[model samples]
Target: MNGCRWMLAVVLAALPVVAVAGCSSAPPPPPPESRAGRPDRGAMLIAQYGCGSCHTVPGIDRADGLVGPPLTRFGARSYIAGELPNNADNLQRWITDPQAVEPGTAMPKLGVSAIDAQDIAAYLYTLD
Candidate 1:
């Protein structure tokens, strides 16, 4: 009986040490920094606004639609909206104000903000 009591006491004494040793929690991950002129963020913003709802964009599935041509080779394409250059600036301008770039088109003014348009251009740049 004494031996059993001593063993139980030893285990009880070690319990607090074990619990304390396992008490620490790991640190959280760092936050991502925003870049105003960045494209991936733009693409993300455009996506968030549901641009993929009517257009075909790679790297983002479930946003596919047959209404517009897929912009798979956007970087390689020479013309956007069939008139303006397919560069970053042009893409932003076109996204920000598509009707202004194209006199008459089915593309409606979704009120996409300027920063979002720019970030979208950055995402399009990744197609290259």
Candidate 2:
């Protein structure tokens, strides 16, 4: 009876330490979602496509441009380049082929792939 009680007390004493160690050893939590529960993949795509050359995008490195309007709050905006609606589908379409959306628009067609466009749109929507 005494041996059992000793073992129980030892286990009880180690419970808090074991719990703390287990939690501390676990991997860190993932980064916060930027938009629509998706991770921030748009930032990389923005740089890869040289988007900063024409527009000033917030949170993107070296995304300062004076030719086009600043995209600081693009996510909150209602329209894309004053033409198409500012939804995911529209954004992807615009990014994939800008000239198709507006032939006369200054934004050229960068030939961005559909997947890259989607990721870019995902990143752009996080500007809010």
Candidate 3:
């Protein structure tokens, strides 16, 4: 009975330390605003230019497009137009200068400015 009481005392003494250690490892709450990264702008420009008229986006549905490839899964894509890096900056450049990158993409120069293209990219990255 004495040995059992000693073991119980040791366990009782350790309880508070174990509880404190558990709390120390706990993660803090996330921030209210999700500003982990900058939003894409090129994708926003695509919508503004009405590129959806040809390509199929998750939210957009229209006919008379057929002028370019679909962009529903562009974020997960490995390459832009199957060559350049599939990222916001590259996408913005592609949207602003398709002919410059592919040289024969048949995607006309829509006169999209750099800032507008970035806004479009910001919108597009949200798709994922």
Candidate 4:
């Protein structure tokens, strides 16, 4: 009984620290604005741009192609196309002009405007 009580005391003392650690490890909540691209618009743009024709994007209809890499966990990726950093700006650049970012890459320049690219990137980032 004494040993059990000691264990309980130790657990109680460490509870707050454990909770803090858990919160710290969690990803920060997204900003409450349209800055990161409209997730809804991004989804629409993904379909409009035929992105599913090559990449298997989650949550998009008929996005089950196998030519390009699956976009699952795209938000978690550290880099884009193994070249540019995986960021909103870089993603926009890649989407609007893939050849300029990586010459000879299979991802063709889709003529995505800057805003549309942001929307697409925003949608991709939500796939965590």
Q: Which has the greatest lDDT?
A: 4
lDDT, candidate 3, 3-119, per-residue tens: 999999999999999999999996753221212334444444556688887777665445237667776655556677887866766777887899999987878778887777776
Clashing pairs in 2: none
Runs of candidate 4 exceeding 4 Å displacement: 1-34
lDDT of 2 by residue, 21-72 (tens): 9989977543322344242677888888899998998888899988888988
What is the lDDT ranking, best to worst? 4, 2, 1, 3
Stretches of candidate 2 above 4 Å error?
Answer: 1-39
Ranking according to TM-score, highest score first: 4, 2, 1, 3
| TM-score for candidate 2 | 0.68
Q: Go through the candidates in order and give each one's C-alpha lDDT.
A: 0.74, 0.80, 0.68, 0.87
Q: For residues 26-101, what per-residue lDDT tens digits would candidate 1 score against the true structure?
A: 5533322223478657667767878788888888757697787787867777788788756666777888888898
lDDT of 3 at 123: 57
Report RMSD (Å) for each prediction in the order shown: 17.0, 14.1, 11.3, 7.4
Mind sharing the TM-score for model 1? 0.66
